[model samples]
Target chain A: MLRDITLGQYYQADSVIHKLDPRVKLGTTIIFIISLFVFQGAWGYAVAALFLALVIKLSKVPFQFMVKGMKAIVFLLLITVIFNLFLTPGEPLVTVWKLTITKEGLRMAVFLSIRLGFLIIGSSVMTLTTTPNQLTDGLEKMLKPLNKIKVPVHEIAMMMSIALRFIPILMEETDKIMKAQLARCADFESGNLIKKAKSLVPLLVPLFISAFRRANDLAMAMEARCYRGGDNRTKMKPLHYEKRDYIAYAIVACYVILGIAAGKLMPLLVSGIIQLV
Target chain B: MPIILDKVSHVYGQDTAMAVTALKNVSLVIPDGQFIGLIGHTGSGKSTLVQHLNGLMKATSGSIYFNGEDIDAEGFDKKMLRSKVGLVFQYPEHQLFETDVFADVCFGPKNLGLSKKEVELRAYEALKLVGLEDAYFYQSPFDLSGGQKRRVAIAGVLAMKPEVLVLDEPTAGLDPKGRDEILDQISRLKKETGMTVILVSHSMDDVAKYVERIIVMNKGSVMYDDAPREVFRHYQELEQIGLAAPQVTYIMKDLQDHGYDVSDEATTIEKAKEEIKSWFARLSAVGKGR
Candidate 1:
């Protein structure tokens, strides 16, 4: 039952986005996340939404599959929306006891929620389209400049990719262990908070031990193959910018420009709405 | 029925892009107090079939019944069923997490809400049944040898006192000595306790030697369900699915072809020995009678 988790899961499909250079996709994902903060108006959000939609369409990833990733962040999204919706001070539209629903608060809350949604969905698009190995190569290349500052950029990228690759492996292992424990009459559910926490000890101990064992075996295997950090290591398939990547970059650049223009015009539009009200 | 799978089929990731049919229209009845060996190549759905016996997984298009009761029926406690049909997974030692061997063994009985005394008693008895020494019980299970750790894991399942013990590749990754010891213990446990034991293994010799019945699987369906000799008679068919009867069975069959008067159905080392001895005895007896 624990296998329902889909976080960091890559959907395998061939499409235009999947064909783009990993470095370009990585840069665009960062750009997209940053644009979520830069643009503050409906016009800006509209541009962002269109950009994300077009990417999803080009990636050939099922819309339902991308939305499935959103389910993981539902609780966090609710907390953010609730905190902003009720706590933000603004012109009171309705008052009920200690609670006040304000026009400005409502506006800010909607905008914030929309912003958070786009941020998550946009990055999910990147991950869904790009494989973990590709993402790692992209990250390492982009972070090459950081190496001059004595940062172990290659090591960091290697670690990140290895961790990402192990997520599903560990998850499957967890599912197996859970079944093994269940066969032993281990009651994980239907316990008090303290008891439930205690129940995890049985599950966690073996999981941790196996994880360490696997890590040790992996290290040994790597060493056996003469792996010694990322120094002078060459990739079989290097990431390169192609015609599709340039087209994608151009489209994303246009979206960012439109978002900036919308941010600049937001105040005028809000004022016009206020006059109408 | 001790366990009955009725037209049971399981499709992993059904309707998804990665959809795979692991078990297909597999209907079988497992009688009580019988030792059964399930043999299959990798990805042949033997694992999926055993999981269904305990309701660990729901069949995609059919039903599973334990003791004639529908497992998927509303209010049926699947957890209880799981405890009743204890499954020791492959590399089960990897599931041992308790600090000490004794504590790990007790983990299963404790979950059944047994009294402290009963839990300890069951754990002790289970450990004893697995042929583990009392000296190793209080020590860290991880500190033990691979075989010892395996004993603790098996004890953990046995403590549940399951009626049907489903061991999936229990002897895997063990040294030959450890493998024989574990198999011997399982055989003894089956005889003494009269528990229905389902042994899933790739070792044809072990299955032929121990289990009275063999269920051969290929491509998610049962190909042969018969006595070891009957099943081994179709060694060519088994070989088609990347499986084979014991090497001794092949040897005997070849010897019989070479004009030796011997049965070619021997599927174990001991059985082949007996067959050759019997053939020699028959030759002497015929000469003396003349």
Candidate 2:
């Protein structure tokens, strides 16, 4: 039952977006997030949406699959929407007993909700197209200059890749332990909050113990293979800036520039047209 | 009453690209108190089949009946079914989490809402049934040896007083002595409690010696379901599917081929020894007559 989670999971598909360098995808995702904050007007949102739609279409990861990741953030999204709707002070649209729904509040809630939703979809698109190992490699390459500042970038990257690799393994272990507990008639469902939390003790203890044991085994296995940090490590598949990666960067940069220009210049152009008319 | 599976099929990740048919139109009836061995190579669907016994997994098509009632029927008590069919997973020692052995064994019965007195009593009995001593009862389960920890885990299930015990490769990581000890205890438990025992293992010799019947699985289907001797008769076919009959079966066949006139049906070492002795007795009798 725990297998349905889609967050940060790579969707296997052969498409132009998936074939692009991971560095390009990572940079695009970061720029997209920044652009979401920069783009304030309707025209700006339209441009951002258009660019996002194009990238998602090219990625070939199904639209439904990308939206599945949004389910995890539904609670956070609701809290943000509620806070914006009730707390913002402006000309009231609707009054309900002690609460007033202001026009500005409604607008802020809608705008912020869209921003959060788009932000999640944008980042998930990158993860869906790129594998964890590739993402780590991209991060390491992008942060290579940090090594001069005494940052252990390579070690940090190695740890991240390993952590990502262990996600599914640990998930499977948890599934097994859960079933084992189930076989003993352990009721994980149909309980109050306290009872439910109490029930998890049996499941979690074994899981934590097994996880530590597995980690120990992994460390020993790595040591046995003479893995002495990434000091002199050579890549089996080194990262390179291909033609497609450069093209992707160009497209993303143009989208960000267009979004910023739309937000900055759209109002002036609208008033200028009104004066001329 | 017997547990019956009628044309049961299970497809993992159904309607997806990665879908796999783990069990295909499988049919079987496990009687009330039979020591049945489920033998299959890896990915042969043995584990999937056993999970269906306790309603741990639902079949994609068809149905399973426990004591003549459909287990998947509306309002059927699944928790009761689980307690009735205790599943001891592979590396069961990993399931032990309670601070002490006795407390760990009590986990199952406690879930059943049993009284404190009865829970402790059942735990005590279960520990004794698995041949774990009283001295170790209060000791930490994590501090015990691998075999002892496994026994405590088994007792955890046993305390529920399940009518059928389904153990999946219980001796997988244990040494030879530990393996035999655990298997012997299971065999003894079956005889003493009259509980239906379904031992899922790929090992031919272990099943041949302990189980009264053997079911061979291949590629998500039952390849053979018969007495140990009858099943072992098709050792060549079993080997073709990445499984083999017990070593003694091959030895008995070899003896017959070498003109010893021994019965090739012997599937276990003890049976093979008796057959070879009888063959010698017959040979000396014929020599005296000549």
Candidate 3:
């Protein structure tokens, strides 16, 4: 039952977006998130939405799959929306018992929720399109300048790739341990909060032991192969930008510039649309 | 009075592009107190089928009944079903978690909500049944040898006193001697308690020697379900499906092919020896008559 995790999972699809260098995807994802915060008016958000839709469509990853990742953040979204809806002080639009519903509060809540949502989808676009190895390679290359100040960029990247590789393995291990414990009549459900926590001891202890054993074995295997902290390592599939990557950069740069310009020229644009209509 | 699976089919990752049909429309009736061997090639759905018996997994389509009650039905008391049908998973030794061997064995009975005294009593009995001496009872389970840890893990399930014990590759990583020891203990336990035992194994000889019935699964379907002799008679078909009959089955078949009066269906060495011995007596009697 624990196999529903979608974050950091790659969706295989043959598309221009997937073919672009991982550095382009990484840089654009950050730019997109920053643009979400920079956009203030409906016109700016509209431009951002159009850009995001174009990219998602181009990537060929299913829309429903992207939306599925939003489920994991619903509770956080709700708390942010509720707190903003009730606590923000402004000109009151409605009153419900002790809670004050102000115009600005409603606006803030809607905009904040939208921002949080856009944040997840924006980041997922990069993770869903790029494989984990390419991601680490891009990161290591991007952070190479930091190596001049002894940041150990290669080691950090190596660790990240290893961690990403083990996620599914450990998840499968946990599933097996849970089933084994369950067969012995161990109840993980139908208990009070503390009791439930206590019930996890049987599941957790075995999992921890297995994890350690696996880690030890992995370390020995790596040592046997003469791995020494990513030192003097050559890339098997090194990261390099193609023509599409430069075009992607231009698109993202134009998006940010347009988003900011749309906020400034919002009134003119709305009046022009109205006159046209 | 049998555990029944009615046209049960299971599909992993159902309704998705990656979906795989793990079990076909397979139906089975496992009677009480019967020792059955479940044999199949790897990924042949042997593990999935056994997991269904204890409700560890639900069928994607179809139902399983335990003693005339629908197990997957709402409010079916699955916990009780699990206690009744104990499943010792592959590498069960990896599931031990308590500080000591005895406490680990007691984990199952305690989860059954039995009294403290009863939990310890059953744990003691189970450990004894598995032939673990008292000296190792207080030692940490992690410190034991591979075979000892496996026996302790088996006793942990046995402590729950399941009516039907299902073991999935219990002797997978053990040496030949250890494998024999554990299987012998399980056979003795079956004889002493008359409980239904289902052994899932890759070793043809082990199943042919110990189990009363053999169930051959291939590509998520049962190809044969009969007594050992009856099933081994179709050894040619079994081998074609990436499985083999016991070595003795091959020997008996070779003897018959060389013009000897011996049954080719003997599935075990002892039975083959008897068949050959009687064949010799018949040959000597015919020689005297001539």
Candidate 4:
């Protein structure tokens, strides 16, 4: 199944990371991704990996559970690695007829793969630890200033949260539809690409129809509840930076500084080892 | 036996925090050509249990045997099983995607790799079995009424000519008349086709009237498996599990408790009427004796 898909999935548990304010967690994830790409050295990535491990442990989300989300992106990961492995021209390391692998290409491939993998895991951690409601509140609060430019921040955040919430519902719907089709002997997994794609006609048409139906129903329900634009709404549980959130923020700051220092010191250390050899 | 579940158990997301054992050690043998009703509250594993019959889901621990062979055994032709035991899901109308009702009904038979002529013959027969008019055949399924759309969806499965038909809450979300019509059609179709029918529903009244055997489920276990009269006798226990017997059962129970000469086994309307008439006869006999 399609239930294996964990898009915007939330795992609830009593832990320091789970208890942190949603805004703080969201900000930390963004900063973490920024630092992941900002620093280019092996030491920075090592520190990043260590930080991710520590966060994963604190969040109480099982490693296996988090890794399952990576299954969906295996193809994308492979494509990115292959592109980086062959496209970057540098001092040649391996050449096989038309395909050339250079030292820089190899290095780029490893780094890019690491970056992408870490990025996914890092974002997954945030989504896993935070509920969609918390995410919506965090996003709205963070984007409050955008309202000065009349950007409809609350509505945008509401739409995002609704979209996030509907993902699992739609996924469940797709599974049901596919099973219904499967019961009809509608094969989806076999045959050539064209044949497989043709098989999807039965599956996709219903999925699309159901998605639209759900959207329409949701719109009607919201309207029936007198949900006009988000003009003057007060939160029942307002977003406030709790004590754990401050602690998380401090830890993230320390991580960024450590990552930057590692990035700066890596060249010197590598050159020193090269000179000694 | 058309289907047999041997202490079957299904666990969703096993070993994870969100793990749920939807079906416990459920062992059941569904005899061929019996109209059985599976009554359970929401999430009572009724859907999961039925899906195992068609090989749509594999049990987490136990095994299911279709015609004496373990369905999970290696090299078992699961697709063939799926075709043989057609499952019409809840809100099956959502699966309707073909431009017209005729083509939609043809989908299952066409997927069965049947020739065009045979597929059409089966489709037409199925539509007729569901009591749809021939005029509705060429119309878009989307253009049909809710009840008609549901009938078309059922016809799609019927076209497969399944030996065992499993319907999951087929009449859910329909008006009372629509519900009755669908149930009546299903009952008629069962009698006509003699397919081993398993109706999964929460409605005691509906199942009590239509099915010969009723299987009552609660919390992933079959609490009662017997004739509707036998199952409804324990209305108190059924009520405890967020389910109720037909209204007539409680009414008869009330009469019985109040020292009336009414039988509490009147689980259906027709049976209740007979119980009342017989009780009136007994009353007149007592008057004559006095």
Candidate 5:
């Protein structure tokens, strides 16, 4: 059952998006997020949606997987839609009791929901296409300039990579511990909220103890391997940007510009009864 | 009741890139009231196969029958099946959590929604079965020694009154004395309760000492399943598959190679000594006759 966790799970595939430099993917994801906020109209949403679909197709990741990825944030998406639908006031499309659902409110709900959905899917596309090691390599390279500002960028990336590497191992350990508890008849499934939380004591105590033990062992092993911090450390596989990376960056820049222009030209959905006349 | 697995196969993370076939087309019937030993190397699908007995894992394809009834059938309580087929996982002492040993041992019967009186009664009985003292019952389980903690964990499962007990590496990582104690307790439990026991272990000596039948798994299939004596007869084949016969069997085979006329089926130390003594007696008789 723990295998259902999809977050940070990279699907290895031979596709153009998967082949792109991880730095380019990281930068493009950031640009895409900025563009999402800039794009306000249906046309802009269409462009962003089309771009995401193109990326998904290039990555060769299944549509059902993207839908599965979206499942984690479905509750948040629903909340955003409901909040925008009832809370935003304008020319009323429908009214019930004290709540007024306006045309603008409806538009806002759909736009915001789609925007948030696209934002999550687009960022996930980057992670799905890149391995954790490559992602950390890219992050360290991108943050190299921050070294001058004393940000310890390399150390942060190293920690992130280590954490990512241990996630599956830790998950397996947790699954084992849970099964052991279950064998002893620890009922985690039934009972009220308080009772359920109480049941977690058996699971959590062992998990925490084991996690700490693992951390200590990992630290000792790292020290034994002479893993002293980022000073004068040479990487076996250094990050090198290719021509394809530049082209990918240029495409993301153009998409962002088009999104900003679309936002400017699109008719603004005004609030209150100003649009009724 | 016999535990029957019919063409059972288990694929971990099916349909994903990380998918692996842990077990394939494995069929076996563990008859009731038998002490069955499951021997295999790491990742040999021994754990995966045993987990299906009590419904800890559902078969990817095929079926598992507990006492002639489909365990995966609708309305069949897998949890209750779990209580009936108690699994004591490796290093089970790590699962202890209650402030006191009594509360921890009672956890199983409590989950079964038994009355407080019944829970306490079963807990005390289980403690006694594992040879824990009455004073140790109210003390914290974590304060006990490693072997004692393991016994407490076992008692926690035994409190459920399981008919079939499945243990994974019950003696792993224990000192020799501790190991013998645990094995003796299990043997006593079987004799006293008449419960069927399935033990998963890597030690051929342990299996030979206790189990009536041995099942050897390699890769994902059962390579050999027979009486302990019969299985150890194919010593070379077992070694080729990365398993070794019990030390006594190896010694007996060495004696036979040296023309001592010892049987290859001598798997226990007592039997090997007897065989060697008989061979020496015959040798002395021949020398005297000459």
Candidate 6:
């Protein structure tokens, strides 16, 4: 059941997108997100969507898996739509039972939802293709220049990689604790809200204990292996940007230019109801 | 009542990109009152199979029956099923949560919605079954030694008065003495309460010494299921699957191959010694007749 959580999960695949430098992928994802928000008209949105679809396809990740990743943000998307649809003040396009639905409100809701959806999927594409270790290595290297300014870039990346690596281990541990409690006839699924929360005590206590134990053990193990931070560390797999990374960046640049051009050229087609009103 | 699994198959993350077949089409019947041992390497689906016996996992296809009733059928109270088939997971002591040993053990019975008096009664009785002293009941479980913590965890399950107890590697991290102590307590519990016990272990000696029947699993399939002696007879097959017969069985096989007249099928040290003694007696008699 815990395996179903696809948020920030990395999928292993051998594709050009997967082989690109992680720093390049990370940078392009940020740029793509910015372009998603900048593009306003249908043509601009279409170009941005096409670019995202192209990147996802190139990554060789299944479309369904990306949709699964989107499952977590469905609530956020719904909230955005609901808030915009009901609260935004504009010229009413449809009125019924003292409820007014405006063209601008509906437009804003759809545009915002679509933009948020693209933002999530676009960034997830990078994570799905790159391993956590690679992502951290890239981040550390990308942020190396900031070290001159006394920023703890390496420490941050190290923490991120460690966190990512332990996520699955911690999840498995939680499942085992829950099963053990269940074996003792602890009813976790049924019961009123308070009663259900009470059932979690057995599971939570052990999980916290085990997590602390693991953290201590890991720290000691790292120290034993001479893992002193940042000063004299050499990576086994160094991050290197290849020719393909440059090409990928070029494509992203072209996408931005096209997005800007489309946004300026297209006539704002606000769902036919706006002209009728 | 016997536990029967019929053509059960389990697939993790079904219909997803990360899908994995953890258990293939498998079927087995565990007779009531029998001490059954489940042996498998890591990821052989042994853990997954045991989880199904108590309804912790729903088989992707097929059914599990307890007392001839379909446990997988809708509306079957899974809590009752879980209470009946007690499972003690590996490193179970890690699940101990209550402040005091008594409260931790009583947690199970209390969750059963029993009266407070009944819960306390069963809690004390269960602790006694695991050989924990009454004086230790009020002390914090965290204060206990590793072995004692493990026993307290087992007692917590025993408080539910399960008909069948399933333990997954009960002695995994314990020292040799602690391992023997825990296993002896479990054996005694079986004898005194007449509860059916299923022990899951990777150690051949543990299974050979304590269980009557052994079920060997490899790669999500049941490779062998029979008496310990019968399973050991296929020592070569067991070795091929990254498993070994009990140490005594290996020594017996070696002694037999060296012309010592010892039976290769002896699974335990006592049985091997008996066979060797009987062979010596027959040899002396033959020499006298000659």
Candidate 1: the clashing residue pairs are none
Using lDDT as the measure, the top candidate is 2
Better candidate number, 1 or 4, judged by TM-score: 1
| Tens digit of per-residue lDDT, candidate 1, span A157-207 | 989988998888888888998888887877789879999999888789889
Report model 5's chain A TM-score: 0.92
Candidate 2 per-residue lDDT over residues B199-275, each given as its tens digit: 99999988899998999999999999999989988989999999988898888888778877888988788888898
Give every collision pair in model 6.
none
RMSD in Å for model 2: 2.0
- Summarize candidate 5's per-residue lDDT along B1-290 as a digit string, tens digits: 78889999999999876799999999999888999999998899999988888888889999999888999999998778889899999999888878899999998899888999999999999999999988788898878999999999999999999999999999999999999999999999999999999999988988798889999999989999999999999988988888899998888777779876768888888888888888889989999999
lDDT of 1 by residue, B1-290 (tens): 38988999999988777789999899998999999999999999999898888877889989888988999999998778878899999999999887789988998888888899999999999999999988998999889999989988998999989999999999899889999999999999999999999999987977888999999999999999999999999999989999998999889989989999888877888878998998889999999999
> Which parts of model 2 have CA positions greater than 4 angstroms off?
A94-99, A270-277, B257-260
For candidate 3, write residues A1-277 as lDDT tens digits.
8887788789999999999998898889888898899887888888989999999999999988788899999999999999999899999999999999999899999999989999999889899999999998999999999998999999899889988998999899999999999999998997799999999999999999998898899999999999886567888887777788899899888999989999879878789999999
Write the residue-wise lDDT of candidate 6 on A160-217 in tens digits. Answer: 9999999999999999999888888787887799988987888899989998999999
Model 6, residue A236: C-alpha shift (Å): 1.7
For residue B12, model 1's alpha carbon misses the true position, in angstroms, by: 2.0
- Per-residue CA lDDT of candidate 5, range A72-109, in tens? 99999999899899999789999999899999899999
Flag clash pairs in model 3: none
DockQ of each: 0.72, 0.82, 0.80, 0.81, 0.58, 0.83
Instruction: Give the better candidate number (5 or 6) by TM-score.
Output: 6
TM-score of chain B of each: 0.98, 0.99, 0.98, 0.98, 0.97, 0.97
Candidate 6 docking DockQ: 0.83
Q: Worst lDDT window (10 residues) for model 6 chain A?
A: A265-274
On residues A1-277, what C-alpha lDDT tens digit does candidate 4 reach at each position?
7666675688878998888888898899999999999986899999999999999999998888678888878899999999989999889999999999999999998999899899999999999999989988998999899999989998899899888888888888889999999999999999999999989998999999999988999999999999887788889998777777777788989999999989898888889999999
Chain A: TM-score in each model: 0.93, 0.96, 0.95, 0.89, 0.92, 0.93
Model 6: residues >4 Å from true position, as ranges?
Answer: A268-277
Better of 3 and 5 by lDDT: 3
